[model samples]
Target: MTTTLDKRPPGAHARPTPPSKGRGFNLLRYNLLGGVAGWLWLVVVLLPIYWIVITSFKVQADYYATNPLAPPTNPTLDNYRFVLENDFVRYFINSVIVTVGAVGPAVLVSFMAAYAIVRGSAASRFLRGVNGLFLMGLAIPLQAVIIPIYLIIIKIQMYDTLGAIILPSLAFAIPLSVLVLSNFVRDVPKELFESMRMDGATEWGTLWRLAFPLTRPALVTVTIYQGLTVWNGFILPLILTQSPEQRTLPLALWSFQGQYTINIPAVLASVVLTTLPILTLYILGRRQLLSGLTAGFSK
Candidate 1:
C-alpha cells in the first residue's frame, strides 16, 4: 500500500467550493421582504409630511386652482417673506427661550431624582408608588388639565407670560424624562457604586464623577427627546400666552390660519424653519442618542 499526501504550494489554485443555493435563496427572500415592508412603512409615515411641504410651496393660484396631488406650478417664497417680516422672528425667539428653559430644568431634575431612586437606601414601595404617580402623569392629557392649569396660572398671575408656558412644560416633561432616566440609571452595575465608595468618594462625587460619565449617552438621549417636546409644545403656550411677542412657533403658525384665507407658502416656510433646528439637533446627537437607547436597555 502506498501512502500519498498531496501538498499544495502557496497561492495554488484550489477547487472552487459551490455556494449553498438554498441558503442564498432564503437570504434573498428575507431581504426582499424586509425591504418592501420598510419602504411601505416609510411611505405611509412620510406622505402626510410630503403633502404639507408641497402645499406650503404652492402660490395662490396653485393652492386653489390646481389639484392637491399635483405639484405647484408657480411656487413662491412670498409667504415666507411675509412670515419673516411679521411675527415669525419674535415667535421663533420665544420658542427658543421657552424650550431651552423647560428642557434644562426637566432633564436636570429628572436625572437627580432618577439617581436617588436607583441608588438610595430608602428605595421602597413608597418610592415606587411615587414613581408610579409620576408615570401616571404620562396618561393624563394636557387638555384635561388645561382649565385647572389656566385657573392656577391666573391665580398666580403667571398667565400671558413665558413663565406660564415654561412651568407647565416642565411639569409635563418631568414624568416621562424621569421614567426614561430612572430605567437607564437602574442599569448601572452595583460594582461601580462599591468601587466608588471604596475609593472614599462622596455621594455627590460618585454621581458627578463616576456614574454621570457613564450615563452621558443616556443624558443626551433624554435631553434631545425632551428638547423636541418643549420646542414643539403648542397647547400650553397657546393657552398661557395671549401676547403675540410671547407666542412660540406653533402658536404663530396656528394664528397664520384664518377663516378668510391661509398663507400656504409662508406656513411651509415657517414649518421648514421650525423643523430645521430639531433636525439639526437630532443629527448632531444621533450617535449618542442611538447608543444611549440601545446600551441603556441592554444594561
Candidate 2:
C-alpha cells in the first residue's frame, strides 16, 4: 500500500474565520439622522412653550408691532400683571378648590372600589363584573354624555356652583382611578392577603393596613392625574357654571378671547399661570407617579 501521505500539519486544517463583529452604528452612513429627528421632535414640543412664555412677557403693542415669531421688543411682566388684574386670583382659587374637592373624594372612593373588586370572592358576580363596568367608562367619552351630566346637575340644583364641575369631574376621573388602582391592587400577593386574614385582620383592615400602604404609588398617580384634569377642565365649568365667580382658569381664559378680538399676550399669560401648578406637581411627584403608572400589568 504505497499510498501518498498527506503533508498537512495536524492542527493546520482549514478553520472557518470567526465572523467579524460589525462596526457599531455608523454615524457616517446614518448621517446624523437620529440627532435631526430628536431636534425636530424637541422643536415641535418646545417651540409652542417658548412662544407662550415669550408672548406672556410682551406688551400688546410689541405683540402686534413685531413679527409673531419675534422676541418681545422689550420684555416685561406687564402682560402677566394685566392677566392677574382681571380677577385671575379668584379664578385660580375656584380651580384649586374644585380640584381638591373632586380629586380627594374621587381617589378615595375609587381606591376602595378597586380594593373590593380585587379582593372580593370570584363567586360574587357583582364584584367580579364591576371592574368591567368601570373599564367601560374609558370607552365612553365625556363629551358624549355631557348633556345628561348637565341635566343631572340642574335637577340637583348644583349648577353654577363649583360642585357642578367637581361632581362631573369626579365621575369622569373615577373610572380611570379605578382602573389604575385595581390593576395595582390585583398585583398584591394573595399570600399577603391570606396572611393578614390568618392574623384575624378584617377586609377593611387588610385594605388600609396592607393594601393601602402597598398601593401608595398608585394613589399618588391617580391624585396627580385627576388633579390635572379637573384643574384644566373648561367645558363642565362653561356649561355648568354660569357666573364669573364660578369660572375655572380655563373658562377665565375666554374672558381674554372675546368675539371681536383676542389679547394674545394676556391669553398666553393666563395660560402660563394656569399651567404652573400642574408643572409644580409634576416636578414633585413625577417619580412616584411614573412608578405607580407602570407597576401593574402582569397577572
As for model 2, its CA RMSD to the true structure in angstroms is: 5.1
For model 1, residues 143-206, the per-residue Cα lDDT tens digits are 8999999999999999899999999999998998888888777778899889999999999998
Candidate 2 lDDT over 1-299, as tens digits, reads: 22258566665676688865654457444668878888999999999999999988898888888887888878898778877888989999999999999999999999999998887737688887787888898999988999999899999999899988888888889999998888888888899999999999999899999999999998999899899888888889988988888998888877666721557887888889989989999999999988886776433
TM-score (all chains, Cα) for each model: 0.82, 0.86
- Backbone clashes under 3 angstroms, per model: 1, 0
- In model 1, pairs of residues that clash are 79-266
The top-ranked prediction according to TM-score is 2
Q: What is each predicted model's overall lDDT from 0 to 1?
A: 0.83, 0.86
